[model samples]
Target: MAVAPLLVFMGAAFGLPAIAIATGAFTTSADAPGGVRWTLSNLTTSVHGAYLTALWGSVRLSALSALLATVLGVPLAQAVVTSGSRALRDAVMSASGVLANFGGVPLAFAFVATLGNAGVLTTRLHLAARGWSLYSFWGLVVVYLYFLLPLMVLTIAPALEGLRAGWREAARNNGATSWQFWRHVALPVLAPSLLGGYVLLFGSAFAAYATAAAMVGSSVPLLTSQIADALSGNVLVGQGNVALALSVDMVVVAGAVMAVYVPLQRRSARWLA
Candidate 1:
């Protein structure tokens, strides 16, 4: 009863829109004999041609960025957790929170200013001669890492801290070295959290539109960019419903990621607790 208002808000805010998208994905625009006929054509179309390419590109970018972030973040998180300085830990956590939220136009513009052709770093460091272009896929990956890496640190820090010292001591009692303890015990326990963190990062990268739009536009071919193009009739007129179908695909991918992330996070919480 106490949460009734929240439930109603959720229904209004999210449920109605989801219902609309699902309907739009399957229904044609009003016209013809019956007016707005139900069809699976949009969904089918969304998975073919340029749409498929966009979907794959988004997935590949997210996976690569998430992987790099997780690989680099774990050691950084472990270092902070083991460090004795409270101030440093607090500063890092605070900075991570700020950086993880730093995206969109300003971030894109910052990269362009520093990494773009004839830009600050490109000129000073002669990056252009080395074939570094801020408008490419790998450049976008590096830009994504600026934020995803921090997000990874924030996500895994609590799990790292939650690791009981008693477990380490017990492992040492059995003649386990540091590497052996990490391999046999720590890695197993931390695996769920690490995987969950990666999923979270992937979702963030996957849904990101503003930075990608501002930075690379359609050159890199992302689903989010495609959706925008479709919605705006940039590719062709009257593609709004198809855009909805593309959004439905994006929603499906995000839902699947959440399905995996939730269970992993719960398992990690149990182990950490």
Candidate 2:
């Protein structure tokens, strides 16, 4: 009974919107005034040069940020999980909890304050003369890392915790070095979790908008920012529909992530067993 209402609510809200936009994408408006007419033209136009470029940029940025987050976050998670002191462990866990929920415009402002031209370190006497700017592509990568890494940590840390300490002790008793212990015992158990975590990180990075828009001011041509700009104009003219197409592109990418994620989830389950 509870499931029925949830399904009905979802269908009426998310499912209906998706169906409408999908229908609108292929078919233009003839009966509905200036609305899109149903044909291949709208989708073809949507798939053209600029949209493709933005899609590629979104994919590349997502991949790089996810990779960086995995590299940094996995280590931090391991440290947090392996820490001896309960207080230290709780503090680190608390910090990760805080970071997971921290996002949107305020996070962007925090980055700008710390890394902007007039920022603390940038404006300090020693660094001010070098003329560094954190508002460019590299800067965006930096900010993207800030958002995705903590999520990565949370995703993989549980897998790390599940690794049996006895296995590590057994390896150590056999004269295995720390590297060898991880190499032979821990890594095999953790690989599937890492892959799944990467998918989540990539998805999060690809969908991010507020931070990018706030930091770079939309000239950077991110797909999310493009969608935002498209929606900002006349609602009746329905240029907003173009943003819907962009959103469809996002849904397609997310579906691709799921394609990879489900198999990896099975693999992780097998590894755990």
| Best-matching candidate per TM-score | 1
| Reference-based TM-score of each model | 0.97, 0.89
Instruction: Flag regions of model 2 displaced more than 4 Å.
Output: 29-36, 125-131, 234-238
Q: TM-score for candidate 2, please give it.
A: 0.89
Expressed as tens digits, the lDDT of each residue in 181-208 for candidate 1 is 9999999999999999999999999999
Per-residue lDDT for 1-273 in model 2, tens only? 869999999999989989987876667555556754556665565567777777887888899989999999999988888887789778877777788778889988997888788887777654546756678777788888876888888888778888887898899899999999889778877888899999989998998888888888765767887777667862235556666777788889999998998898788877766
- Residue 143 in model 1: shift from native, Å? 0.7
Which portions of model 1 show Cα errors greater than 4 Å? 31-34
TM-score of 1: 0.97
